[model samples]
Target chain A: MVSRIGKEIELSPVEMASRYSSRALYNLAAGSPDPSTIPVGEIMNSYDRVLSDLGPRALGYPGAGGQESLVKEIENFLPFLGLSIRKGERLVVTSGAQHAIELIAKYLLENEVVVAENPTFVETLTPMKLRSSVVLPVSLDERGMSVDELESLTRTVKVSIVYIIPNCHNPAGVTTCLERRKRLAELAEERNFYILEDDPYRPISTGVPPPVKSFDNNGRVIYVSTFSKILAPGLRIGFILANQEVAEKLALLEQNDFSTSTINQYVVADLLKRGVIQGRTEQLSSHYGRKMKILVESLRENRLDDFNPPSCGFFLLLNLHKDADSVFHTALTKGLLFVPAGPFFLRGGETYARLSVAVAQEEHIVKGVRVLKEVLSQD
Target chain B: MVSRIGKEIELSPVEMASRYSSRALYNLAAGSPDPSTIPVGEIMNSYDRVLSDLGPRALGYPGAGGQESLVKEIENFLPFLGLSIRKGERLVVTSGAQHAIELIAKYLLENEVVVAENPTFVETLTPMKLRSSVVLPVSLDERGMSVDELESLTRTVKVSIVYIIPNCHNPAGVTTCLERRKRLAELAEERNFYILEDDPYRPISTGVPPPVKSFDNNGRVIYVSTFSKILAPGLRIGFILANQEVAEKLALLEQNDFSTSTINQYVVADLLKRGVIQGRTEQLSSHYGRKMKILVESLRENRLDDFNPPSCGFFLLLNLHKDADSVFHTALTKGLLFVPAGPFFLRGGETYARLSVAVAQEEHIVKGVRVLKEVLSQD
Candidate 1:
């Protein structure tokens, strides 16, 4: 008796991800944080400290929104990371950034039209699609999502939400320029639509502009980000920064999960109290930055595929100029792993493939590119 | 553009619950497990060990359904607790029992008819209501939710799901008899409806009959249970046992949360591997058993109100024979907290209140009843 959702989880990309075995393959396919950058010792200490301090309360339901100490830490740290709740806005802790997207899609979408980039993260779009939202895919340019296209699309059909990555877009790592961020906010204000600014990659993405939310004077931008990129994905800590009304609605909706792991929240709170998150995020930014640079340099040196080198963040998309299926399969058999682009879009991207430098070391990045060149040349 | 959820979170019941202060008030209104029963040392050791061993993977995504070690532990422990996921069955770990319910309601309820016990747990109903399901409240007799009413209701409307708290039912704390369990399963097979056997209180509840899921041969029953009663809720671990197809579908749905806490899962897994849960649960069963007995005896001794003594589990519903509003208010001022019945029902529960003995000590139970007696006599 399942209610048939409009979109289903595509196994092709996931299968590509699985092919990237940890010790076996030249893995450039995962979006996971760099293992070296995770604050293992500090996280261990924080867990011990939180468990000892909070005792049983750490394992209980953390109130309506979240644990007070954790919320305060988030508020204290967000501004330094270029997010600000300010005046009438509030926040709610979530399981992860995906859970944040699910809340907005499940409660606020109302089956209205949503706009996303042509080649975007499928994970971000799945929950929105599950809510039966009519999706309009907008293409990205050098500046990011074309505001002119979004403005034109709004005239044709009523758009309720516009989901934007803004910084280090998945599959296609394109950072929105400051002008585009402001323009996106302006468009949301003019259209009376909400801008779901998904900023999961921002903290680890180098030189990110202020969030679209900063430009949203009319409270049309809902900011969502996660600790997955900077801290650890397994921690499953993400938060939504929205207007108090919407935040309250989300908090009430979050009651559905009982609460995101209270112990996890408290541990994160302990880390934040010690100011570990800031130093760790800076370390992650540089670690991923160096890896992204190595990947780009090797790809350029080989001159195997047509792609723009991303300034920062985990992923870069290669335009294979033809179907990437043969290239992907041949590369996989050769012990190199990168995701095919078919699953990252509403319809197209058959001629593209996404390469991730998130978990790859400098050697793997260079070696992975050499293998990709061999596969591409043969294809 | 927030979707107007049909049932807004009832503040009244939540407000009644909130009136329970931790340190000062005699908290007979909470479903929280006793802090004394929490295996703090074991959990702390487990977390430290899992993190030290697994390193970065401990804090990364636990994969599709859950962490492998945790799922295996669930597979092992469930049968010991009288829940058997035999051939063709599968399980997916959730954030909590509430998350398991949310998944079913959001994905399966297609706004179809749902039958729940009269004065059911509101947190469970809130998610179902959000999915626009037409909920039909069925009253409970000694055995549990009246199967006759359920059978009659199914004849008129297509009942998609019947949510049952089989063992130590919340609010009422009524255990469905073994015959009733078999009958519920048979009714589901005949009706082509699903039975969501919510058994959060089973491990601690004394003399619980085998679950309705155990009686089903047709794969029509989905079992939902949690570690909150036996362990700590702040860990936020719960699971669902269903047919492989449904389990896969639910796992696909769970991709929205990225994953439940990986660290928490590993910690729980470590504890399970060490067989800490078996001993801990037995201790909890006896500890809570004594508390329930004391509360019932004290109430009977004082002749405070009308209530059938619960054999086990956390709660007991007292029939006040009059509206409990004034009595509740007066009791609260005199340092007592018990949840008023208004919030537990679909419509009417004015003459009742649900008392919980989960966290209270023997002294608090006796003193709470005396307070109740004084409040009742004043009214």
Candidate 2:
């Protein structure tokens, strides 16, 4: 009874991560924030105050985009991430960054060709893939998605969209440099295609450059970011900054999901109001930074292919350069869980493994690395 | 660059309601609940307790379906609405009942022919229309959507699905009779077509017979209901009770939206756990009941064509028996507002108006009806 698109739907990485988080003693898979970093008491207080102060007003219909106060807060917060809302631009709040991508993919892409990093985040990629006729993946260098290849490909294929994770690129951990960001923005304008600059990890990711959207003179870049990384995924708050016309159109599509949860907006808005998020942001940076450090050091000390650690955010990806399937099975028996990077790529990532430290304690990260080393040495 | 489906998306009734609720002095348009009865303090308490108790755990990634506690709560609460989760039946929580419709419409529906009531809830119908090749409208009688017409429809058209708003029908406040419900269930089985029993207002609706799902021996009926009407739309919580296979399929589709807000789920589960919703249910019935009474009485006392009031839920549709365009315009000029029934019907409903008492207080309901009566009498 399901449709063709429905049949094509697979278990997303987020779902796989959730399973690993629960089942594994040493969970190195999920990108979910470490529970310790979430400001529980602050969130609770903000929610209490919002519910009490707004009464039923908070729970009533939030109209099209979102709670007005939250929208303003989001606008204010965007500048901190080196993004500014330009004239003739507006914002639409979505359930999450993933939802923002779904709206763009389903509404904007007309079964046309899409371009993304070769190892893209398929959680977002699946929606775009299902909607579009084809997704052409560009190779990634140290500076992020290779716009040079994208520029070359644009000669043959009329690309409708270019989706990129600018900071701490998933499965590759390459931040787009400033030079590349400007070139990508220029490429988008020249090609008359949209650039979906997906930047969910910016708050936690270090050594970030200005987002590609920041450089776009035209309204070609749609900046998608979320509270899930900084605040909590349970908050399910995200927004997209786009041209006013595009934002209005996406808001119409958003009516189908009704609106993002009213209570959540109030809480997040209140959290911003009370300046709780900044503190939470620092806490997250330190928390994830410490874990990433331990994992990278363990990898180095154990002489497992020497690589620099991701500056911040979740876990770093490892290019196993060996058969991933057997290693994965062997590790599964020992209860050390890590996400295989093959699913993150639309094509050609069969041997890579993404090891997330989002849920792992330091000891587990150390021990999990030891197990990975032993597993790799057996080959 | 927008897709055809995106181009076809319209401003839904929920969006329209949000606009009217904000702009109108006396809103007789929005189906949003009366602010006075929303159990604000109770919700505040529940939210506070849940956050304090669950803390970071509440804000983490909820797996595919929903928070386990909330699912159990929803399951326990199902019996009160004359629905039950039978053996081999499962549930998947959604952002809202509107969202449930979108999921089923998008994932389950192919470009097949769909059947809905002539004057159906377009908020839900729009998604179905966008997905399906055609939507055949069945006539509605005093006993709700005419089962005989649906039976005839199946003969002429190979109907893939039959959609119905079973209780306190959105524009027509009639409930389905048990006999018709049984026959519809049987027809669905005999014809091998799915039945989407949309029952958002079931908790507040009165004189509702056992739902069509109750009569189904086979899993032909997918029950969609929400906490929006009974609790608040701000909660943005709803669920679909379907066969395990069907539920699993829908859950996989849900991974796209990620999951419904975890905090909202925790708050709702807490409300259910504390039995606050039962008190809130009684509160809503009496509160809406009084406003509805005032609106109905004013309509009759002013010698407007007499009509029966909806037993409960948000609004009652008046067969304006006049050019609805002029009536609506005149009412607008006089600072009174109501929904024109034109958009509610896919076919014809040119002269009807739907008057809601959901948001208006008793005095406003009385005054709004007076203005509406004067506008109608001028003809």
Candidate 3:
């Protein structure tokens, strides 16, 4: 029998798509980066270099937090994003950003209120909901999560953490404005809530503003990011930057499963040392940027309901003039697969659907959008 | 401030040792395979082959259960150990056995009684204890966890799961007899409890009996094993073999963090295809077997209290005639680092200590045992 928490977690759309069939013609369901841009050669070279140079040390346990060299490399890499860590602040490498969220939910949000955007990442919301915490879903517009609503909610609720994807909100793809980021940081100080800034897409996307942590003066922002989008998901490398107090606790909690993959840490460290990640990110942004443009232009030509084009990240949220479920099933019949945005929201997301430009090629993007237009026109 | 679960978890001894310094002369404290024995060359070859052959597929998401190719490889490998899976039986690859244990404890043992051996793996106990479940620590004699104690406990306490390391108990270094394994499996059915048999050390160690799962007829046993001990910990590959019902649920639960490493799965699959693991395991058993013999002889010569020399696996249990804490401190001064087995037990473990041959050289094992003898003689 599944435990209460286990029952609360459902198979995400990406998982469902993979299980259904490997023959799906247009895969807009998964928010993964283009597999073609994974830099397989560079990764293979890193593995060879790490194993040969470090010998067996690369295969040993990487300690509780992670490999020290990798952590230090991550520390060195952070300054490039306009974020700085003080002496007392610390970092803990996790399996991925999803794991970072799970650890935070388990360690920091017991019987506390967690505020998030109404239509947020479904996977992200699952961990918070499993905690049985008070999840107050604030609405998000083009400028991102409504701070005015968050402020009002904080007046009555003891908000512990506000989970935000500042750069490119998953499923919604709307970036929070700089002014709102500053206000959110200030609200965290005044209301005494922590900000869990999950920013996996920021590094590999253009027009992403500085992270909320850059505006955080009180160490209330827990900055998290993953190399899955920029480098490769198979590496399972993600890191959390927080104050020493929280970081130490997270490190201890990580002892439950030992460390993340030691070989992965070594490979990531080697890549960072060689400046491979920086170069790859630039190439990825250019590639995905083209895909995003193609999807946006195709959608506009189809005379669909007006929607904001994603400035950065994998997804584009389309506001539908009709029910999303019918459109989703019909598109599937047309050999197209994309996640329905309804599950992403706490309420009233039936009028919205998300298209991911991450997995599909430019040609597939056009074909998938045409299928979507046909499905919507049928309704 | 940390939440309840975070507060309940503490820095394990292995973690403390690693964080204390990277230059520890003797790392007998951690039960990790000797780094030098890691098949780095083979692993490098696998990586090169996987990247060149599978390309981006190696770096893509591995779905919920795992890469089908890797799962099939593990399925084929299990029959070599006298274990068979029915059509309904399933397997889920995890980050490691430790993670598999955590998942089981989280998904299956909530608000239930979890009976484990006294002085069991400290890391294994943490997840069950964190669940706030009633953990009944049964005593273990040379034959293994006293099935009589377990029977008596189950009769009164309604145990949900009996966590046993059937082949080579971690701290005690004793194997459960074949008769006892069969009895334990039968008892699980009679008592309506599940048996979580963690056997990571079984494959690479000689004289270890076939897993208790071989005796399991009614699907009451959930068998979990990791490649960390045999292949390399850095691979973070482990698999759970359970009945179809439980296997399906475990796969769904794994979706909480997407899946394990895709590249790792491909690499492992390639290695299995090439029979690298089979060969490496033979070499490892030979290597560690010699080390185990040396440590046992040195301890016997120094007149340590009578204890079971492990027939298989990594550790030796030394019953001390004096307090183990004092010996532990004194041995540290002499450049030896082994875990005091006191923490492994719930009570009366002050007189026991564990020496691991897993990470130490034969010469260092001798030197460390001599220091242990000197420290114990002082008391």
Candidate 4:
């Protein structure tokens, strides 16, 4: 007998594309990098050295509480983000930021109200919704999650958790300002609700902003960051920082989920410990910075539609005259791909589409924008 | 505010250990292999080669379904376990087998009756309970999940899922016979319940037995396996083979989570394709086999406990006379560590404990068993 839930799941956009399209069809949709551009050689070298020290078991099940060296290194890494958590108090290595998010949902949100930005990364919403938590979307503008809206909403919704992308917000690439971050932290403290600060796109930019964790005094903010964007995503390495209470809950959740790859954490920790990641971050920021410039300048030159490139992260939100889904479908035929912002919105999302600058090369940027110009001009 | 569910959320014994004990004190409670044992050097070689060929993008967000070559390798690897599904039918590469198990719980079991062996793996039971699935524990003997009990239960309860350890059962180390596998498969077909054939330890045993998936002609078996035990768990690479309907549903669930680490998959596929894993498996089997024998025979010679060395896998189930928790706690004081078997049980699991012989060296096994014997002799 087929499961009714099973029948409801639509095939993912990535899988469908693999069947119809040929040869890595410009994947701006899934918010992944152009694989050819990531620095695999250096990572492999670091992996080689780490494996030589750790051996085969490094690849086996990681420690239930994460490897000590990695946790310690992460502890060291957190200070740079403006949070000072000891390895034991606040750090955990997860399979990905998604796992960390899910753990927080499982541990903290118990059929309670979860406030998320209206147009947000859909994956972040999965854990909360799956847990049967009442999801209340707070509308976001170019300044990230609107604090005023959140403040107003929390007063009524009895919010259990607030999921925010403080840095270069996904699908919208809007970084929250320091004042907003402080106000949001204040609201979370006042409401006595936990804040899940997801900042996966942090290292790709030169500009440093105060994290929610930086403002957290009562240990309410659980900061989640990933090496996936900076080092690589396939490593499945992400860590969360919170108080011991939250870390313990996450540790318990991870204990059941199977701890993240042990060696992946080791390899990453070794890289972080040895300053390999910091060294590479310089190259990564420059690369994304150049790509962001290329995308913004090209869109302006072509005058495709009203669009603004934010200061950081991988994507830009384009204000489209036509429906985002129709533009996405038509652009596929013309070999230009981008995520239609319609799917990002839980409430109503019709006028905008999200384009990733991470994978768009200079040549592709020129060609893609021209294609977008032609396709939009036709309609 | 503390979550109402947070206070209510149950944790496995290992999870409790992670929470209560210091990291050093919690060593033996967790069943994950020591990170020091992973074959990092060999995997790093593959990582280097892959990186040279593809670069950093390989580690970025993976193809939503899975990496193509890695999925193909997994497809190739599956026939050995008696599963013959098409390339894209119902196979998904997950973060780990643990994640795959949770995915099944999410999609298949909807508070429906699930039958697992008593003294089961905690990770398996955690997700089932988390989903509020009605869990019924079948008894286990030296031959694995008691088929007669399972058959009788399947007939009575409206069973939707049955999780089995066809090779070497975790905690139990009992390998079910081929006849029982066929019986289990027939029961699944008869009752229309899915069999979750978890075989992480299958590759570790030189003495291969018939798997339920091999006998699964009716497509009721969703076979799961991982390189975690054999290669590296930290790679967090595992696969689930089911029919097209089941596979597609799991794929959507995975897309919601982080897609399997792409670069890890590529390196794993390379290891498989290049014959590295095959060579490593032989070495591993021989090495862990010797360690297993030493631990078993020593236990017999010392008359320390009533336990059998696992026929295959890396673990041994000890049925102790004293309180299993106290016995384990005392052993840790003696600087000897092993997982207490209480957490493995679905229902009654207080009297048993699991010791992994895989990681303990031959000399350490002799010394460890001597310590265990002394501990048992005390009082």
Candidate 5:
């Protein structure tokens, strides 16, 4: 029988996305990962090597956990993020970070309450809602997730899982401070609830911050990260770090779902072995950093002063003087689109917008902000 | 407040996949689109040249509908499948076929009953389950979904959706005959339910069979296909074909979830344009065909007479002389692992095992079958 949750579940946001045509106009509404920084050429070369390594056998299905070489490389990459995951502790590769999020939500959550950051990545809330979770949004400030708000929410609501983007949040682009992360981890320990620490933007940061998973001495934090942002998003590769019990459950889930794209794992592993990933990250940081400047310059030139400059990731948060809906519609007419922050907000959204710095050219950045300013000022 | 549905959703199989090690023993359980076939090298080259064609300004987030060039290519590809979709009708790149499936489940199904083929792809059921749909498994014979059973169920139950794999059913490797597809399509029209035609393996088949979608003159079939099977699963690229109304609704659903991996879409479009996809498909078909022979040869040598040979796809169903579970355990000891078929069955799963002809060397095939024999002969 179909669960009762599926029957009653309905959200218009996803439906809105389906109607979107990439050819229609500027689509700033989507929080898609940036590809300009993807090390495609190097990854392709690595793919060739991986194919050569596997020979004819590579064309077939891959091993259970993932391609060993890739998993080992993932293990190697974990330490760089300050996570101390043992090889035997469960680490599973997924289609993307979103799939991992869904998996955790399905397993740990039993239609219980989940506490999440308000104004969070709207995509994160969908799976939780589908599962019939009572998702209460924890408030956030400049320092990232409000630990105080999280504590209060947990005290009142029995939360089974807490979803957080510890480093460089999506849409908001706010990084949690180290102290807050420690407090958050400590809270999870005290509450006896699991933490899904999403860190897709870790490598893209201008400077690294210690991950919440790094402070997880009690195995409460299941650290999830993806190479899609660093190497390629299209590859649809991501991993999760968890203890054996949770890992085993997830594996059972994966056994039912399609396993992670195996050949990509092999090629990614090859890239790690060849030290291409390091070079790629460095190159990407420089490339996207330049793109970031263009967007920032345009915002400054246009005197759009209400926005916050992001420390990392591909987006900037714009606090417009006018209502976001009117500005969004006006900007769309002018061929410039940006994601409205209303949907991202857990509590009904106020007047904030998200602008991606990854894809725009230097001139458009200037023009986009000018158009945004024109729309906002008029409204 | 998070939507009630979000909190009640279950963990996904892809998420659960994290339990095992990537580098571990031989694994026959994976539906990941092979990544080596992505033509990443070609895409890298296209990335180099896109600047020249579309110019630097053309590179951004791309139009929300999709890259015009990529959608046009899909236009060309659809005709081969006998679909004549009009331009500007809703079309978008998705994360993968599985994602497209989930999107459809979210939109069209509302507290409804979904009829799926028994022993079908487990991932297919995950989204349905998460959506709280009552999943009624319709049994499958060698000719694909049993028509008599479907007709009987529809008469007795109120079903909203039916997921059918007309060509090359996963795990089972059974293709629905043209007659069965016609009957199924007729039933859908009579019952006023939508048919989700999932055909990830249709192209890989040596002989073409009429697609269930092709028979749908009434637009009841929302056909989903992926580049994952033909290109790379890591690219996580897939598409859905449906009437404008259904497509529009699904587009909205997509807005809430993660958008299709844009970088991967561009890469696929570029590969298709460069004509690299043609060579890869040929190579893939040839490779799998030969591997099937190796698998068949091994079975013949082992004198395993209980299994039926699959006409297409990479799997074969083996009927053990005794309970398949004991054979599964014994095979594990010999390091010749195949997914036990008990999990595939919806009602009873003790009699069968599923083996993939896509991997394993000829020698391993012989040895693995030999191991199966030794284990089975114990009785």
Candidate 6:
């Protein structure tokens, strides 16, 4: 007897990409980093050290909110964002930033209203849809989520939470300006709504503004970040920083999966202590920056479409005059692959496409963009 | 503005243990395995081999159902229970068996009625309570969940799922008879209810019968197992085996976390390939068997309490003459630790206590029993 799943649990873009992974050539549909950049050797060293030092305790069930030392390490690391771990602040390590978001949606936002950017990270929207009754999509300009539109929506309907990717916004590649960050935080305080600042792409990106959490003085923002972008996705280490009350609630919700992987947490803690992640993030920023530059220059040289080049992060959002879905299908046949922006929005995004420069090599980037150029020219 | 979590999301036994972890001298509270029994070196070797062989690919996102090779390894390993992986069967890897149970409750039993053993694994009940409107607790005799009670319950209330821990059942230490297993499977098919056979403790235990899944021929049983009890809990690797349709649904539910750790999956796959887990299981069974013997003999000599010595698994269920909660508090003062079974039951279990011989040394088991004997005698 099979149980029926809700529409929200159906296959999304990530699963679709994974399903047709072998058929894809350029493979830019999912936002996975270049595999070569992962520090396998360093991680191996960390594993050895963690296992040898801790023995079987490393394999034991981790404390709720994960290992204390790792939480402390994250506390020490947060100063890099111009944010300090306050006295009453609590950190709960999660499977990833997505899991952290899911926990918040499940425990806090039941039957509530959530506001997200129009072309947002689709995976984050799934949890809200499953839990909240109303998921409002606000339009985004170059500076990121239009506060005027958000305010206009909030005046009519009470918003419980606002989900945002402030730094290097996914699918759009537009960073929220410092002014917008302050205004968003202020609006969250004024409207008495929680802001879930999902900032996974911040660590490995350069010239990024501090997270909206840094500007939140009234404990209105819950900061979520992941090592998936900066370190390794397989490690599945992420943490949430919130007020003690909210953090305790999150920890209670985390009891669903017990604690996250204890070995992974210890391995990450060792890496953080050794400053391995800090050094790697610097290397990754430059490496991805170069790839983004190559993809942008190739697109401009081919005189195909109009788009703003992202200052940092793995993706470049192309605003095409043609339908993105048709172009995506045509380019797929011509051995090029990238995510169409249609699925990213709750409403309309037909002319938008997101090209990830993370997975492809320099030569592959050049080839893939040329194929896109050829397909668009024919149209 | 901290959002309030529902009362159902309050602190459970696991969280209670974590909150006072430092206070407990002898931690028999949770059923964690002995550190010495963990095959740390072999697991480390597996890690080394997996990382080197697969490199950064091992660190990337796994397939929706998990790594194909690991799924195959699990499929190959399942024949020990007299069950073969049928062509139409599929496997979805989970963070743990608990997570597998959670997914089943979330996706399969929403707003439905669930039948669980009265004194079942407390963590399993959490998800069911969160999702299902009616969670009926069926009584368990020495042969495990009473089929008569379940049948009677199902006659009145429509049960969507029957969750049972057939082999070496958690908290109760009672294994279901083969006849009961067959009947339960039959009843599930007849009642049109799914059976979630959670069997995490089967591998490392001795003389355990085949799982209920072996008796399930009509695709009514969904088998959930984990590497936590046998290999290492820190790896957080488990699998769910079901018919293709149900398996696909489970994979869709697994999308919440995206996938389990890829590196851990690869490591487990390598261990299975090398037969390390098979060899280690034999060693662990003997090692834990000796500890169980010591605990039983000590309890008998000291006239501590009446109990069924668990033939397999980590726990021994003690039937105390005195109140279990009072005895637990008294034992704590005397530096002895064990779980009061009152919390495990949905109804009355004030006199039942659970002792875990998994974590303590042989001397500690004897000493703890002596202390427990003294504390009970005082009443």
Best by DockQ: 2
lDDT for each residue of candidate 6 in A1-379, tens digit (9 for 90 to 100):
2333344577777667556557777776668878989999999888899888998989987656778889889888888656787778889899888778877777786678889998898877787777777788998778888888888898999999998888778888788888888999999989999999999888898778888998888888999998998899988889899988788888877777753788999999999998888777678999988998898899888885477667788877787778988888888887777888887888988888888988888998888888887888893
DockQ of each: 0.63, 0.75, 0.68, 0.50, 0.17, 0.56
Cα lDDT tens digits for candidate 2, A1-379: 6786788888876576566555577888878888887878888788778877888888976566877899998888887788888999999989888788888887887678999898888788888888889998898876778889999999889999999988877766667778988999999988999999899888876457888888989999999999898889988889999999888888888777774888788888888777777556666777888888899888889887634357666757687877666677788777778888888877777788888878789999999988888888884
Q: TM-score, each model?
A: 0.97, 0.97, 0.97, 0.91, 0.78, 0.96
Lowest lDDT 10-residue stretch of candidate 6 chain B = B1-10
Total clashing pairs for each candidate: 2, 0, 1, 28, 63, 0
Model 6, residue pairs in steric clash = none
Error of 5 at A326 (Å): 1.7
lDDT of 6: 0.81
Position B363, candidate 4: lDDT: 79
- Once superposed on the true structure, which residue ranges of model 6 sit more than 4 Å away at CA? A1-7, B1-6, B18-25
Candidate 3 regions with alpha-carbon error over 4 angstroms: B20-23
Q: Report lDDT (CA) for all predictions.
A: 0.81, 0.82, 0.82, 0.74, 0.67, 0.81
- What lDDT tens digits, residue by residue, belong to model 2 across residues B300-331? 88776534457667768787888777787788
Positional deviation of residue A63's Cα in model 4 after best superposition, in angstroms: 1.6
Worst 10 residues of 4 chain A by lDDT: A15-24
- Distance (Å) between predicted and true CA of B13, model 2? 4.6
- For model 1, the stretches where C-alpha displacement exceeds 4 angstroms are A6-12, A19-24, B6-16, B19-24
lDDT of 3 at B114: 84
DockQ order of candidates, best first?
Answer: 2, 3, 1, 6, 4, 5
Question: Model 1 lDDT vs. the true structure?
Answer: 0.81
